[model samples]
Target: MNASLLLLIVALLSGLAFWAGRSRSLVVAGVGGVRTLNSLPFYYGSLTAFWCALPSLVVIFLWSIFDGVFIEKLVHPLIAPAVLEAAHGNMDLVMNQVRNLAASHVSAASVDPSVVAAAERLNSLENINRWAQAGVALSFAVIGAIWIWLRINPQLKARAKVEDIFRWLLFSCALLAILTTIGILLSVLFESLRFFQRVPVTEFLFGLEWSPQTAIRADQQGSSGSFGAVPLFAGTLLIAGIALLVAVPTGLMVAIYLTEYASPRMRSLIKPVLEVLAGIPTVVYGFFAALTVAPLIRDLGLSLGLDQWLAISSESALAAGLVMGVMIIPFVSSLSDDVINAVPQSLRDGALGLGSTHSEVVKLVVIPAALPGIVGSILLAAARAIGETMIVVMAAGLAANLTANPFDSVTTVTVQIVTLLVGDQEFESAKTLAAFALGLVLFMVTLGLNYFALYIVRKYREQYE
Candidate 1:
């Protein structure tokens, strides 16, 4: 019996015990003729149910985490020295392998009989777990029934007690989610700190280049792992710039059309169609950029008599950025449409009544009112453009040449991270660790943008609301 099944079994039994206790108490209190409760039998049932379920659920929760460690300790001491050494130091891996071997139907090459025996032992442990589950679930039900019976009285405050427990449970669940996010950020920060210790923090932050390739042995000691990150940062900024240039104005216009002018039927039709752009997998956009968009741009440039050496390739930053903009179009359009529509209709009407044209009212009153939300949406889209992986990976080149030309190819940080961690690279090396460092920087950048957006929204809200 796993923990979830045990929790559910306890909850069901608790509900039943609650019903029994409430029915008996109602009969004793003269609220019913040897029958139901006055405050609704279901409410009483629920109250008793919560009590029976809550305490045992807490116990099951605590037991789940500590039980495995305790069981492993006992099992290890019982094993022979040869078996223990053969299992290797990875207890979890050995346990998983044993379980798989026990369950598997196929016999492969290099199969050992000792492993087979260990697998058999695992089967025995499985049976033991089933028995323990049944025993514990029964114990919980019996104890809960007895406790509810003792607690029931004619004037008992069962409803309030149930509510208190439920409120605390919900609060604890919310806190758990927030704590998990903090835990993840802290872990990333610590790894980045380690990376910075080996390579100087100032060099990483302020250096003008980024190429993480270093020597392995003394024979090849002098290698350039130039931590200067200016070019990569500039490449990211340039790609994101091109993406926004395409995405913002087009998305805003679409939003205005949808919100201010479209009929109800047209809106229902158009909103879903716009969202379909969002739903298209990003990898598809990458393929389109590499195959279709890049060639079109290159041909257009040739027609204008541009240098062939400087023309866009299939993997140019412009191709990737344009595709990425198309991918995030729904984000800008949908968010802007909602915010525009949310502005009171009376405001638009007032402007029209004061001898203003429809376009004039939209440009002067509606847009100013909705500007904060629009800015927030644009910021989010820019951040998305910066962090995107698949579109850039399939379309942008791996070279980080610092140039302002939209036709030239450039690499993004995400593409670098993927290449660094690909195949069988050593994890302890600086090249791999640099990915974590880059992640930490990316986190900080996005966080700053989000906070700035919030500040603008708050200031605007203060003036308007």
Candidate 2:
């Protein structure tokens, strides 16, 4: 249903764009709305299409946001008071179960009569929502068709109208992307706000100790755990630094070999093989890290006279970092290759004409020209490293150690977030809410890096262009 709604929206938006383009043309032709509509027939057509689709979509979106809660509220009261009380405040679970029961090929055994009735009511509500959504979609389709028919006139300056509509539609689409990003940031900001309320924001932000081993039950020991994030942040930087150190030179070299020196046959063979690195799953890399790379690092470090006290476990940051670097090499290399290849052949010939070696031309001209894209690639790779969960969670240690040692065990922010919210916990609690704070921090860091990277790329782009 979600997929269908999105597709429907895209289709509707396309229709609106077409109509807007046509209508704008007519309006530009100096037709007045009061004087038989200033726009061409096509312009009128697009206007009709835009109004029919956009208004309905807005309504559908608004309705969807409130529909589930509204239905749940209606169904909750109908549920037996005894059942509701027995379930306590976990009405959401009960509701979900009821939904599952209704959808299930076979229902789970329910002891409460009210629960069963509620499940039935929930099914009824789902059907109603489905019908309502279907009706709205169909109505919009009909309205769009009618608008198209009415406005599609040969006399109508559709081209002008279409262009105008197109511009507005593009503007709207751009705004939508920005708004979506803002919405995400707002949601994270609000959750982080809630987290700050339960825990002092300063204590959470700047504390040196982190002990998130909170208890679920009141009687259980360690119910109140520390929220210091220093260790996780250190771990993240340490691992990311190691990964970049490994990946950058290696990936850049591969990109150079492919773009500058490799023979046609070799390029054909090697480029795909390198790109194939990206298709390999991070979990596969994790397995390689945990089972293969980690042990290798430990054995190598041990052989290099690192004593047992200088303990480098199989799950050291170096191990995870090395493997993660391997995983991200393609991201750096592929982007670098494309950008390098895009450099003007004339620049290469010009350098060669001056008796510069192939390597020199590449070093002096091609690389400088492609530096923006290369930086963008590195930034993207850094983003991947920062956001990576599976490899870090699997290969890296869960200990929130703040040590700078590459050989020592360390946990990343993603790993901590996963561990923090892994099981049943009240979303309202400090521990659970801490995940949001960590997430916000992670997001801000990544966003800042990306923004900086893009700024550099844009500056260089203007220089070269």
Best by TM-score: 1
Overall lDDT per candidate, in order of appearance = 0.77, 0.80
Model 1 poorest ten-residue lDDT run: 31-40
So what's the TM-score on candidate 2? 0.82
Per-residue lDDT tens digits for candidate 1, residues 133-192, read: 557656766777677677666566666766787799899999999999899899879888
Q: Which candidate should be chosen as best, given lDDT against the real structure?
A: 2
Task: Summarize candidate 2's per-residue lDDT along 251-306 as a digit string, tens digits.
Answer: 99999999999999999999899899999999999999999888888889989988
Root-mean-square deviation (CA) per prediction: 3.9, 5.4
Clashes of each: 1, 22
